[model samples]
Target: MDHDNILETNGLNHWFGAGEVRKQALFDINLTLKRGSFTVLMGPSGSGKTTVLTLVGCLRAVQEGSVTLLDRQLNGATEAELVALRRRLGFIFQAHNLHESLTATQNVMMGLQVHRGVSDAKAQTAARHALDLVGLSDRVSYLPANLSGGQKQRVAVARALVGNPALVLADEPTAALDKDSAAEVVDLLKRMGAERGTTTLLVTHDNRILDRADCILTLEDGRIVRVDDRH
Candidate 1:
């Protein structure tokens, strides 16, 4: 029951496959993400960075050890429980994943639709506010097909944050953007963390954004090898 931490993993180990062909993926991984803090996970490919992210993000089931997210333990949690927990998280992937048929506001409204009681009008209001926060207020009615690469990513960011999720999990979110766009997206995420108290755990290989992280964790061969805490 650590109230200050939004995520905690203790002795976390993961394996792929079963029987004689089984292979271990993650070691005894242990980490903690404090509320409103921004953390970056960086490592070489196949070093278990994404594995850790997926586990803590509730996209994958925990095989061994404990993973506590938002004051609830993930180990042995039912599918229904996991689904409920996932609604509280915001996820941003490398791909923008916008529906071509939808406008920016409509796309963002999709994020809030997962909740039980939000109406379309209210969702649209929240989505517009989120787009405004991400500097996309003018593009609310624009379709994703008409937007630039960076603008599409901004729409993705707005979609993720519209729900007011407690934690935001990003996997290479800036990979597809240009230099300036990447910086802008990262800066927007940092501002959101500062202003909204949204905790973020991002997995990135882009070194340009490392300087902005409050804590940077480096993994190697499925083990956490370095932790650089700027704060």
Candidate 2:
């Protein structure tokens, strides 16, 4: 394991279905993300961007190749080990995925619920602070249905960051937002990566996000085709 890298994959490969119908989804995917770096994975649909994200995120088991995350190999890990590793990661999705009945604070608190032993009061306080960081302090009590699309996404961002996870995995987080909202969310993620030393691997096709990335990896036909490092 390289001390500076938060994630590393070598000879990563994947396929769906059994031997006869197995269709390759990823091939020889060798990649790495430096600690606290903000990396974007871009590719067209069916180019296997999400597959890489899922593999590195520990959401799916690694079939072939080696995945070392936070210093642990994922290739033949048990389910229990995967569960513990996942707790150290934060996830954001295009849908926001907030519970409709829960208020912003409550929703954000769910992020901490995954970890055992945090008191309710502490969780609530942390949730509120996270909301404030996202400029939603005044709307902490609002439910998802009551908040604007951007505001809801901000809540999602807060939830993802509330735990101070070592890494964050986001899939098309800005896809449903307007121009301003998308920019706001992207900026917030960058800020978190800078201030909290949080590593991020965001999967997006939106070119707007490219400018904010420290590095961008472009995938095509299950292979990384381009690597752009911006400062």
For each candidate, give its TM-score against the true structure.
0.98, 0.98
Residues 1-231, candidate 1, lDDT per residue (tens digit)? Answer: 579899999999999999999999999999999889999999999999899989998999999999999989999999999999999999999999999999999999999877999988899899999999999989999999899999999999999999999999999999889989999988988888888889999999999899889999999999999999999
Q: Please report, as a residue range, the 10-residue window in candidate 2 with the lowest summed lDDT.
A: 188-197
Candidate 1 whole-model C-alpha lDDT, 0 to 1: 0.94
lDDT for each candidate structure: 0.94, 0.93
**Per-residue lDDT of model 2, residues 39-63, tens digit only:** 9999999999999989888889999
Worst 10 residues of 1 by lDDT: 188-197
Question: Against the true structure, whose lDDT is highest?
Answer: 1
